[model samples]
Structure formats: structure tokens, C-alpha cells
Target: MSMRVPGGGFDSTNPIRLDFPQSLAVYDDYAAAQKAVDFLSDNVFPVEQLVIVGTDLKRIERITGRLTTGRVALGGVLSGAWLGLLIGLVLSLFTTAEQSSLAIIVGTLLFGAVFGMIFALVGYAMTRGQRDFSSVTSVVATKYEVLVEHKVAAQARELLAGLPGGLPDPFA
Candidate 1:
């Protein structure tokens, strides 16, 4: 059985869902939730009847470094260079008798680097110092919950009972 995400423009099976899911266990970390599922799998509990859900979503951004003009320019140049290189290679693939592949590639690479650097710097400048630091951002769940199809919830819960420390459920 499958479901479609509303307005997600999807016309295929949705693997992120379970039918009549019941929370079998919840844990503070994904590992714990995964461990419970692993235990169920080990006990032959028809693992297909399970799903792991991350709850209490939180967005975190870890600052990597401070941004500078030179750094921005270099980053842009490298990015643009890569794009240019890709375009050049594609164009070179259909090179004619009068066309030189080496020239095409070199030209594209240089152009890409220059364009990338300029674009990067311009974008950074437009940000107007609002965001000056480089950082990586990610959304994480504060807790993970192991859920099972309603029909197999009991079986899964029973199997998880054998885990070394057993599963912990604050709500239970």
C-alpha cells in the first residue's frame, strides 16, 4: 500500500508512510529508535511493518568560518570554473574539424571560474553583511519514534523487550 503527499506533485509510492501506524517506542536519539527496529528485525518481526519518525524538529546552523572578500571571490571563481569546465567538455564532445577540444575546455574552465567568483561576490554583497559567516545548516529531530503497523505493534513491542537495555518510552 502507498500514499501520496498532498501537493507534493508525486504520482508514486510514498515510502515515508505506514498504514495505521502505532507508536511502539520512542527514544531521545535516532540510534535508540533504530536499535529497537533492528531488534525487531532480528526477531523476524516483518520489518516492513515499521517506520521511524523523527519528532520535535529543530534547525541548527553550525558556523564554519567568517566570510571575507578574498574568500568569497575565490569560492565564486572555483564554482564558476567548475560550471564552465562542464559546459566546455560538453561542447568539446561535438568538436568539429576546425575546433580544438583543448581550447574549448580551457576556455570554459577559465570562464566558469571567473563567472562563479563574480556571482558569489555579488550575491554576498547584496546580503549586506546580514549573513557574513559561513555555516552549515540542518534540521534535526530532538527525538525519534519507532512506529509499527497497528496489526504488528504488539509483536514489535514484544521483540524490542529483548534489547540489552530495553526500549524506553517516556509516555508509557
Candidate 2:
């Protein structure tokens, strides 16, 4: 049977080394990790053979929510962009320009839109697809975990063992 292990971050001293088996998937966030497990179950991945390691109650709930949402990052970048453009337009009015040209107004709008898009893209890229902002909640921290496909946990452990940081804490 495949095993699931919560991969933990090693402290500064005495770095933990794990031999993670093959067919393993690592998730930085607990919710995303669990979501994958849930999806696999609904899509013919056996639940009985599944193992969830190293997660807390809060992380489990968050991952369960991701499973329900189907991996859509909740926040609306478009809406944010629109609001930013409106604010930019309003602020443009306060600027002291000798003549208000059509080009100037259009340019301001374009600038606002472009900047908004850039900001959105940068933020999105930095997040690496974990920004579920629609619910007004923030990701507190990153959770590392190794999940193996059903019946491959042993192989996964063997593979993980060779990885730089693949050990699970005996205490945790």
C-alpha cells in the first residue's frame, strides 16, 4: 500500500534526511495536498489505501475546502484591475495638467490597466497558484508533504531517501 507522509522542514541544525518512496507527490500547502488525494479518490483513487501524514486540523480543513472548490483561486484579478483603474482615473483628475487631452485620459487608463495586470501577474506567479483570496483568508505558512500513488508508498520512500531533505520526523 502506498504511504503518505508529512514532510517537515528541518531545523537549522541536524537537518533531517528522508528516503521518500517513488510515485510521490509533494505539496507545499496542506490544502492542495489533500485536495489531490480527494480528487484521486473521486476519480478512482482508493481511499482505504491512502495515507495522510503530518497535517493538523486547520490544514486538513483548508485542504478539504480546496477539494470542494476544484482548485480555483478565489480572488478576481479582473475586478481588482477595474477598481484600480477607476481609482487611477479619479486620481488623474487631481493632477495639474495645462490641457486635458483625450490621449492623456486614455493613456492614464491604459497605464492603470497595464500596471494592474502586471501587479496581478507578479503576485500570481510568486504565489505559484495558492492564492485563494475570495474567502478573505490568507495562507499562514507552507506545509511540505509527500504523497504516493496508491500501492506505491514503498517505492516512493526508496526514491525519497535519496533526496536532499526527505526524512520524516520520528516525533512529529
lDDT of 1 by residue, 7-100 (tens): 2222247765676888887899898788788787788777777778999999999999999999999999988988998999999999998999
Candidate 2 residue lDDT tens string, 73-166: 2233354556656766776677677655555566656665666556656666676656544343333444545445445566444544544444
| Runs off by more than 4 Å, candidate 1 | 1-12, 169-172
TM-score of 1: 0.86
List residue ranges in candidate 2 displaced over 4 A: 1-98, 137-172
* lDDT, each prediction: 0.83, 0.49
Report each candidate's C-alpha RMSD, comma-separated, in the order given: 5.0, 17.6
TM-score of every candidate relative to the true structure: 0.86, 0.27
> What local lDDT does model 2 show for residue 105?
60
